[model samples]
Target: MRAGSFGQLTQDKENTTQVTFHYVEGNTETFTIPIPASEFQEEVLQLLNQPWLTFHLVDQTVFICTARLIKVEIKPAIPELQGQGIFSNSMRVSTMQRAAAGRLPMNT
Candidate 1:
């Protein structure tokens, strides 16, 4: 099994988040994750500055690793919703998309 590495999260593309892994004890391991559009909220953004983040592996095992924000490449344009925006068309779009995908929980 490979030990998870410590690093930061970056957008590898419009639909992917890349995890840059660096090992302090053994070989560094890295990976990427797909996140919901709602992940752009301010609360989540602050999480990027946290010292460490707890991750649950696919095996149900937990991994605690330090998150270092070495740098961030500024994109030429912000995302349509900038990962977070309320009271706008983007919010409406997100809702519609979720409903279409059958992700929105039914009230009854």
Candidate 2:
């Protein structure tokens, strides 16, 4: 697995977010981005409007073609926080809760 500076998916990593890119050719690549929940959402929206996205790694930079990208998955890097946002702090809120608040669909 390719672990980035944002850290890996562990129970203790609540500050990190896991972003997975799915391509049209049935290939997928996952990256960990260390950003807050709101910031991460903004970044994703910006990426969707761009033609290409870049990932700066330790020794190299990876370029992604947005045209061939089929899907993008965003979730907390921590397994225990699966139902919560990136930085939920103390008040834990699940996707269902957010959906009820009209933030997202109730059945996504």
Candidate 3:
């Protein structure tokens, strides 16, 4: 599981209570996803054309991406009642390392 802030809230009626959060799975990579402002959903579907990419939301705004199915945990969000305005949130991501299987390397 990971933790972060829901950066900003959108004005759209359907998105008013949603916030976007930025997260990184490993050391230097980053992933971002938008979710409901106050609730955490079990599953999240992300639109990606690539077949090797997958996305998962840990909390309302924090998300993670991986190519394999792994265990994930979610943490509680720290409500910021003082700042009800819209803003962007940043988060940190954690991932488990796995051994690579024998496969032909792809050529660029």
Candidate 4:
């Protein structure tokens, strides 16, 4: 079977979350499949049986590998820590102070 990508989302009802899967590509296509929370593992197994590139949820978006049998990196949707509003100024100040302190040896 040819490897392809799929997307999944989780929803909650009665304090339990359900997972849903959607086929991203194929000839016999299914737009989506809603799976109960209790059946999550089984659903994942079923998808993997097709050897599909599963897109996992990270923060707000889903990320799927570009190819099967290949380790593809998925960059996070969020900005880098240094670029984040909470850390940017502090990071810059710390970096400048460290530079002024001079470059120390690799090990302590």
Candidate 5:
């Protein structure tokens, strides 16, 4: 139920592995699997090595696409703030936030 950007991802030692998938069309899905804490890396590696990611849900299994490509079709990009000065960052942030908030001028 999120819009605009690929949503957040939070991981910690106390929880199982979780991954969120975002599509080119703006759809998203998340899958969480309770796995042995010691096998976290192994599990992730196994999944990433496969062609697609599998989700073993309660009722059924879901397969998500995982093809990798060098180029992606992206909409107008929000400039990433790097090591710029504070004022420059602030202005870019304002512009990006406004665009994300759907406040762009009609001509744009």
Candidate 6:
């Protein structure tokens, strides 16, 4: 999640694609599909070409009629840094070493 202005809610940039659809019936719905950052755009484009759009949520599958769609807003956000990289692991180890030696690691 990224910080914003005082009252703004932070959004998680986890590996997901946000697709907002505005139908002709004046209904708007947004969905977050679990997709990797590298393939977000291509996947979304493929999904949109079909007559029925399907999303697999946590407990259910949502189907949207693409025929009634009037507008769509697709945003492929920057995903958060996964802590599996070399720099992240090294930093974590360094911090743990400092704490073990009775020295407090400064927060970034």
The candidate scoring highest on lDDT is 2
lDDT of 5 by residue, 1-108 (tens): 466333323333234544566676667666665653445544443555678766778899988766642222212122332243413323235767877778655674
lDDT by residue (tens digit), candidate 4, 1-108:
333322221232322333323333521211222333344433443444554444434443443333332221111111232322333323235877888678765765
TM-score of each: 0.34, 0.56, 0.20, 0.21, 0.43, 0.53
lDDT of 2 at 93: 88
Ranking by lDDT: 2, 6, 5, 1, 3, 4
Off by over 4 Å in 3: 1-26, 37-40, 44-51, 54-108
- The local lDDT score (0 to 100) that residue 59 gets in candidate 3 is 50
Model 1 lDDT-worst window of ten: 1-10
Model 3 over residues 1-108: C-alpha lDDT tens digits?
A: 233323322233233232233335323333333444343342322222223443455653423344433332223332442333523375544332222322446678
The Cα RMSD in angstroms, rounded to one decimal, for candidate 1 relative to the true structure is: 17.1
Which is the leading candidate under TM-score? 2
Model 6 TM-score (2 dp): 0.53
Which candidate order results from sorting by TM-score in descending order?
2, 6, 5, 1, 4, 3
Clashing pairs in 6: none
The TM-score between candidate 2 and the true structure equals 0.56
The Cα local distance difference test for each model comes to 0.46, 0.72, 0.35, 0.35, 0.51, 0.68
Per-residue lDDT of 17 in model 2: 70
Across residues 1-108, which tens digit of lDDT does each residue of candidate 6 receive? 455543342234445667899999999999876664567754555666889987877899998988899988756643433434313322235766867777656578
- In TM-score terms, candidate 1 sits at 0.34
* Total clashes in model 4, counting residue pairs 3 or more apart in sequence or in different chains: 0
